[model samples]
Target: MSSMKDAREATFIGRRTDGTRIRRPLSPHLQVYDMVQITSGLSVLNRATGIAWTVGSAFLVWWLMAAASGPQALAKAQWFFSSFLGILVLAGMTAVAWFHTFAGIRHLMWDAGHGFDLPSTWKTGKAVMVATGVATVLTWLIALISW
Candidate 1:
C-alpha cells in the first residue's frame, strides 16, 4: 500500500500547499482556462458552426420527405416552416451555414499558405465573422422580399 502511494506520487509533477497533487495538463481543457486569442475563438466557432450546419441539414431532409409524401404533408411542412419560430430557426441555420462556409474558405486559404501571421489570422477571422453575418442577413432579406 505504501509503495502504491509512492508510485502515484511519483507520477504527479508536484503537490500544492494544500497537498493536492498536480498532473500534466491535457489537451482541450478549455473550461479550465481563458482563451486569449481570436484564432482560438474562431477555431471553436468553426467547429461549432459545422456541427450546427449538419444538424440543420436534417430539417432540409424533413422538408424534402414531406414534399415527396404529397400535398397534405407538404402543406403542413410549409405551415410550420413559415411560422415565426421556424423563421427564427431558419435564420439561425442560415447564419451557421454562412459562418461555416466562410470559415472553411479561411481554412483553405491557410492550407494554401495564406494568413498564417498573427495579424492576418485575426483579420481573416474577423472577416469571416462579418462576411457570414452580412451573407446571412442578405439571404433573409432576399427571401423575405421575394416571398
Candidate 2:
C-alpha cells in the first residue's frame, strides 16, 4: 500500500489565515533623523579610523615579537616591511594611528560635554584631521631622511 500525503499542505507564504498576526511595524520609530555634532557624518569616519589603529597596533606588536626572537626572524620582518604590500600597510597604519588618536580626543571632549556645539565641533574635527595629516607626513619624512 502506497500512502501519499498531501504535499500541498506543507508551505508557509507569510501568513496563516486561522488567526496569526503577520509582520508588525518595527518598534522604536526612526523619528530622529538629523545629524548632530556628537555623532555626525565626519565623526563616524573617525570611529572607522580608530579601528584601523587597533589593527595596526596588532601588526606592530607581532613584528616586535618576531624581531625579538632572533636575527633571522628580524631579517624576515625587515624584508616584509620593506616590500610594497607591507609598506602600504605601514603607511596606512601611520595615518590610522594619527587619525584615531586625534578623533579620540574629540570624543573625550564630547564625553566631557565640551564640544557639543555644531560650529565648534566642525572646526575641531577639521583641526584634528589636518593635524593628523601633518603628523603623518612629518613622521614618514623623518623616517625617510633617517633611513
The per-prediction CA RMSD against the true structure, in angstroms, equals 5.7, 9.5
Number of clashing pairs per prediction, in order: 0, 0
Minimal lDDT window, size 10, model 2: 1-10
Flag clash pairs in model 1.
Answer: none
lDDT of 2 by residue, 10-124 (tens): 3322354877535433344236544544446566777787677777787788789987898898788888888999889999988888888888888898899897887887789
Q: What are the clashing pairs of model 2?
A: none
Residue-wise lDDT of candidate 1 within 61-94, one digit each (tens)?
9999999999999999889889998888899999
Model 2 per-residue lDDT at 62: 71
Model 1 weakest lDDT span, ten residues long: 1-10
Candidate 1 Cα misplacement greater than 4 A, ranges? 1-28
**Cα lDDT computed for each candidate against the true fold:** 0.86, 0.77
